[model samples]
Target: MNDMRIVERDVDTNEVKIAARDVQVFYGDNHAIKDVSVDIDDKTVTAFIGPSGCGKSTFLRCINRMNDTIDVCRVKGDIRIDSEDIYDPKVDPVQLRAKVGMVFQKPNPFPKSIYDNVAYGPRIHGLARSKADLDDIVEKSLRRGAIWDEVKDRLHAPGTGLSGGQQQRLCIARAVATEPEVLLMDEPCSALDPIATAQVEELIDELRKNYSVVIVTHSMQQAARVSQKTAFFHLGHLVEYGETGTIFTNPVDPRTESYITGRIG
Candidate 1:
């Protein structure tokens, strides 16, 4: 697959990013995520992989408080962005989301034109002061998402009219338009073809130059292809986490080895 493997950051890089400590999640009476802790280095892509219902997605949602949308879901433990506690009561979820953007498995675009889709975040967050500024933001985000050339000719076309892959790229542009420091993606390529998946994967690699990216996927190969680090979860617990190359080639946990070898999910 892709050869852009992850490398450990320099201690003096001056770009430390998100850190999670004893993070846990619960859905009403059922605990979904066990105590988990990990660091997401700046300008890196960290992939989460595990069996279904193993809390990979749940933990991802916790990063940006997406679980708040579920009435019964509750997140516990500490999540910090650059040493600031994101779970603080004074933290505004809306503003936090702008700082830590997310792209879901399904492409949920606004019922608006492609241009508007990319411009929506900047508009709502007051990041652009004028039409020209908004246009610039939209163009930059689309380019960063690697879909600008393809859709540049039809900026006014409805976002829903694009192909599935294109729609997802539009969604990515929308998320990055706000200039988020972190990008969380949940199975972003689950709906795209191989060619489209490769395009998106390449975009993910490029995005790490500006923001820390976290992804949850079922495909072990995809995790190996796109992430510098890989985290494996089992039965709501983080079973193993380390460099992607090391995890795939020499997993320290038996559960991880079993899962990677196709002996268990």
Candidate 2:
């Protein structure tokens, strides 16, 4: 790994939304991530693609401080969102999470009514002044999640009762209800059928218009389809980062080329 050449290119012309520098993660002395650095652009979809256990998801968790929940996980380095250090002692992880919403690999919706699931964040954050405002937020968020039409009539129904794809979309709506600036998805489509995955991919494209979308995906095809920027990780190192097309077609690093060509994973 030490002899591997790493190539990083800043191809996105959009405004930078998140900047990570010299980031490292350790789980009880097990170094899960190395010195990874990258600039994520606002209103753009950036995909993290690598083999299993390549630290893509771990690094994703660091953006929202989700790793802090684990007893042995430790993160070191500077991660800034809109120029604000997310790891600063003064920053509240709960509040920081509101700004950086995450959707996990599975469609894990709270065991509550659909309306309540989407309303949970807004209520806790005091984002709504009244029932009417909360209702508006829920509707807008569901619409953004592209599941409003399917669930509008059954808002009082249980969220978990929905199909896997609908449940995922509902979870996305719940994440968006708080008006998060960045949306983090950890292999969101891995559990869905091809059609549902396409729907979610389309929704991701729509979402990039408003939020900085960072997705950790094992599927290179999905990464190529949905993201404008792509980062290739291998053995805890970011081997290459650039425009998605460039990373796929003309990677500067041999490791990235090998991974892209199915010679290595």
Candidate 3:
């Protein structure tokens, strides 16, 4: 990612990086996400945990406006980053996506060389004007993804040729290549083995130092281990959100407690 550009800006850690109010998501006739409001701080990891169909992923997609790709999906609410209205007609979705990169549940790397895969975003976004610039961006991204040492030997190797864990890390490196300020992940380690999951979890922690990271995971334990703030959603409603310690040990909502205790999903 073009993290160099971010250094010039005044990144206030105390200020809210993302703020959503009365957010609602509807898929055709079904309301997938009900009115939800939450503030996500900069340089922090926020986890969204819930059962399947609980709308956690749906809401995570809302942060990056990824739902716009679905014709039947409609998002209505105020979602702002740096106090700028993302829903404003003047805002370009393409540019918005570049600033808010996303990692999907599966590792969907481009069927291109490892170098090309990481360079793709920087090229498309015009973040690099020269070959040297692109090369630097690719290396920095891979380092940030924490996989450079493993794959730097063969930059031209097919990205699909790597192991499952490597592929996921490459995908993450690809996301970071765009120099996004915020990273949204949807069950990033679901398909990974335990060892691979641990690697991604470690990378997620490292990422929060530079970009605000928001993750949606079904694994409560993983969320507890990685996130500073936790938001629990149930049946499209935000059940509880607070400090990870409090949400796990002393929840203000019974639904949250039930889900945490295994009595309910």
Which number leads on lDDT? 2
Clashes found in each candidate (C-alpha, N, C closer than 3 A)? 0, 0, 1
Per-model root-mean-square deviation over C-alphas? 2.2, 4.5, 6.3
In model 3, where is the ten-residue run with the lowest total lDDT? Answer: 1-10
Model 2 stretches astray by more than 4 angstroms: 1-12
Candidate 3 residue-wise lDDT, 233-265, digit = tens = 999999898777778877899999899888998
Score residue 27 of candidate 3 by CA lDDT.
99
- Best of the two (2, 3) by lDDT: 2
Q: All models: lDDT?
A: 0.90, 0.93, 0.91
lDDT of 3 at 5: 19
- lDDT string, candidate 1, 161-202, tens digits: 999999998899999999999999999999999998999999
The TM-score that candidate 1 achieves is 0.95
lDDT of 2 by residue, 1-265 (tens): 2112223343447889999999999999899999999999999999999989999999999999999999999999999999999999999999999999999999999999999999999999999999899899999999999999999999999999999999999999999999999999999999999999999999999998889999999888898888889999999998999888788877899999999889987
Q: What pairs collide in candidate 3?
A: 1-177
Relative to the unseen true structure, what is the C-alpha lDDT of residue 215 in candidate 3, on a scale of 0 to 100? 95
